[model samples]
Target: MQTFACQCGATLFFGNRKCVACGCDAGWCDVCRRMTAVSSDGHCLGPGCGAAVAPCGNRLAYDVCNAFVPQSATGETIRCRSCQLTSVAPDAGDPQNVHRWRLLEAAKRRLLYDFQTVGYPDAQLTAAPPLTFRFLADTPEKHVITGHADGVITINLAEADPVHRETARQQFGEPQRTLIGHMRHETGHFIWMREIEGQREDQSASVFGDHANPAYGDAMKTYYDHGPAADWPARFISKYASSHPWEDFAESFAFYLDMRSVLDTLRCQAPQLVGAGAGDLPTMLKSFQEAGVALNEVNRSLGLTDLVPEVVPPAVVAKLQFVHDLFQRYVAAT
Candidate 1:
């Protein structure tokens, strides 16, 4: 992530609420995708305000909100745009909700930051229909489930627990798992709706296969009953992807994120890997492969399987090239 500087030229993190050098209060505007300063006395949560928006109720009582809301707000409580993506929020009345909500918020903001940094301009947190987050209480009477629907993402509050999350990682057989990973994986489902639009979706269908064919409910039932398909690793990035087409899309999206982030990290940690070139995806892919090898060697020295997997077969690499070409064409057409 890039660091932001205040008007006075003092460096600040992207999420800084106040600029220490200039003593200016700052928050991110989803619309502008930049930091905006708020007046010292009070700030507006209005539509145009660039401040990182949150729930007004949290602000009034807790005085800890950094969310921006619409100027036309006329309700008992106002929710921020990002918060609206959540369909399940922990009970505000419950004190434990505060800590759990904070954890989800941090991960969600990070996901948004990464999304915006990439080419997806339409990604934003809004309060209109509201992107809601529900942290479900873990109780025997209730079955906690986490997923996204419409604009909402539901996360089981138990996932925030170290033991619970670790257990899930083992159960799912995922090499890497974290709250951020969960958010990234789920957001993939949300963005897939945007990616597979128009005829391109049909073309994507040819590659990823038809998503509409399955009795989705039945497929999910069979998946949970019998587990992911055998030989899943040969074809899929993760076992879960073998469960359904939608899941494959999400897994592929998550791998795309992993690629971008790992590439960025290499650019910083090993400039030699990037070399002296700005190239298209094929060229970038070659450079990235070299970087990946170097990174893997380093990991091996440290006794770790490369956190960045080298699973792109020759055919998969070509598919990645196709995606890169598609992205370039998209930018040109837009």
Candidate 2:
């Protein structure tokens, strides 16, 4: 969530198509990875930067993406790195789908940016794990389910509709849910495939139970038939997390990313609170709780949902710590 400087000395934001103060056009430059002023013809006009870039097809056609594709890659790559990761996009013919797709892409952009800031590889690393997305809507013959498999993350288009999403939240008894939360949770599975599945079985089992046992399908059926354990709050981050070990990991990973986002914003905007950045899970969680109290209070005052939960169970914290350490290693190696 770091702000970028425009050539006109105005602050530019990530999704901004034009700088409000300077009236200069702004775009996300692939070279600098920042929102910077761009000329009408697609030359990056940022300070000391003149990389030739092309607007993503989604940007030029749908006004959905604000990023650019490298000019040299125009032949083979018509989309920006973030937009490129999407293998399937919602149909634009439907007016509702257009709005829903726009919101979905917006969330995906923020998710990818969070990954970039947190030191996770997106388009930068050839060795990085495969991660792609599909934004599909339910049809007469097909039910679009949201989940991840073999590096592909499928997000149901309805999630972008606030009414549909809020209904799901109440039905599932979830404290909070959003498009970005869905991205983080599903990417959690993608990361587990690359980093945890075969790489650190022992450590993962120690943190979250053996995912191999009980068979995921059987476990899922049992969970649906007979809700989560009554004492799940003691050991899991969410009731749904108690369904299976894999779910626990994803929930923990998603929450870890959420905390990281919060702490990173704090470090940037309120340096006094963050002090040394999000150091470790323990430190980060402590800072989040301290800030969450105020955040939750503010939401309460405004009659909005709480930004953070009232509790972070010790067991869930351990799982988050494991995830934190795992990614920290990647950061250090990078």
Candidate 3:
């Protein structure tokens, strides 16, 4: 993510709601892609028209979202572009649920920012077959699985709780597990269905296999029953990715976004640092590996585990390249 500065000149972050130095209300400007001060009259003090804006409806109602919407926006309710994608929210009567939902929304916004920064066009949630979200709670009798269907991504609010998420991460033996990771992975599924399914069928098949295979369900069942092949690391980015062709594509896509986002942030923060090819996949991967090594060493010096534990093997690298190429095509078309 790019570093942001408040109008007061204080360093700000993407999720900041108040400027510490100036004590002014801050909101992200979708047009400028920066954090800007909100004037007393509710106008954005950033670039563009300085239009009168209102806090997201979700924020006014539940104190969750930090996005803003034009005050004159049509409709009975005003929601920021990000909140407009949420079709359903968890039970807000419970305060804990509200807090968890807020965390999920924050991560979701970051995922959206990453996509926007990388030139992915927003899938208009106002259009037919809109991209949407459903944050659900796990009941006493049943567990909620995080998955994507149609254009809706359903997230179990439990994942927003670090304790629960960490326990699951340990249970599943994953090197990393995060709410943002879940959002990125599920988004891959949505993009595949909406943008890639028919458009790049031949190219996708050559990398991830045909999604129409009759054994796809069996493949998933086998994976859950017995787990990934021992040599999965040789080809797959993660064990879950080895379950099905669709999953493989999503996993690779998620990792591609992860790498690109981190690389972009690094470049912005340390422009003097060279050799990290920002646009070329092969050179970027090489730079990533080198940076990972140095980062791991720094973590070790601080008596912590490696910052990035997964190794990007050659097979995974090739898959990542395919994803990069597909995204470039999508951007060019747009």
Candidate 4:
């Protein structure tokens, strides 16, 4: 992510809640899409962005968000776009839940920022049903499954507990798992609903196979009955992606998002890599591969988990290309 400059001439980060250099209250200003400093009287101090602003309700109530909503004429505090999409928030009475809620909002804001930059509607988190997050803890009578159904992306609160998430990641043999990953993966389903479900079934099914052939429930049951094939690396982006065609698409979409994020960071932090066609898929992937090797080796030297995957299979590249093209069309049509 690109860093912003505080009015104090200090670097400001995306999620920073205050300017450390000048003790000014700070929050992300949606109008300017900048790390904004605001005066005590609610006037935004972002360059060329002097609108009135107020803290998001969650920021005021639980200190979970570092975002501002346009100040209401009635002087009522409101949720920011990201906070508004949270249909079911974690219980705030519990201290741990409050912390977990903060983590969730931070991740959500990152995902929304990426979406906006990439030309997706979720950036605004404008409505419900088609896209929303339901963060629920498991109850004695109910288990919160982390998946998308009818556009609602339900997350198990336990995923915010690093220990629990790590244990589950190891159990499933996943390459990586985090709150942001979940958001990207789940939104992949929403993308399917928007871009492919009824409009281009033949084209999508030709690439990923028919999503409804065996039925999702049947496919999921069979996947658990027998693990992924040994040759899955050649055909699928992840082991879980082998469960069904829809899953394959979601996994590939998630990978594409992840790849784009890495490439963006590289471009911002190391501008020397920018060349003609720098934003093109193949060019970006080639650059990422070269950088990934160095990044992976550096992580090894530090005895840390590899920061990037070693390779992207040709099959997965095709899937990524599909995702890229879909968004290109999405952006153009808009």
Candidate 3: which stretches are off by over 4 Å?
73-77, 123-127, 273-277, 302-305
Clashes of 3: 0
- The number of the candidate with the highest lDDT is 2
Q: Report how far off residue 197 is in candidate 2 (Å).
A: 1.4
Mind giving the per-residue lDDT tens digits that candidate 1 earns over 72-190? 33445665455545565677777666667767766776666665545544423352333456668777888877887765667888777778887888887777677877787777766
Order of the predicted models by lDDT, top scorer first:
2, 4, 3, 1
Global lDDT scores for all candidate models: 0.63, 0.84, 0.81, 0.83
Residue-by-residue lDDT tens digits, candidate 2, 133-168 = 999999999999999998889999999999999999
Pairs that clash in candidate 3: none
How many residue pairs clash per model?
A: 26, 0, 0, 0
Instruction: Give the winner by TM-score: 2 or 3.
Output: 2
After aligning candidate 4 to the native by TM-score, how far in Å is the CA of 184 from where it should be? Answer: 0.7
Q: Could you give candidate 4's per-residue lDDT for residues 1-334 as a string of tens digits?
A: 6678888898888889999999999989977777888888988899999988999999999999999889889988899888888989988889998888889889989887778667776542444344788888888999989998887888898899999999998999887888988989998898888778889888888888888898999999999989897788888888988899999899888888877777766677776654433376898788777878888898999987887863678888888888889878767878
Better structure of 2 and 4 per lDDT: 2
> Positional deviation of 139 in candidate 3, in angstroms?
2.2
Question: Following a full C-alpha superposition, what root-mean-square deviation does model 2 have from the true structure?
Answer: 2.0
lDDT of 2 at 328: 82
Candidate that beats the other on lDDT, 1 or 3, i.e. the better one: 3
Shift of residue 103 alpha carbon in model 3, Å: 0.4
User: Residue 214: error of model 1 in Å?
Assistant: 4.4
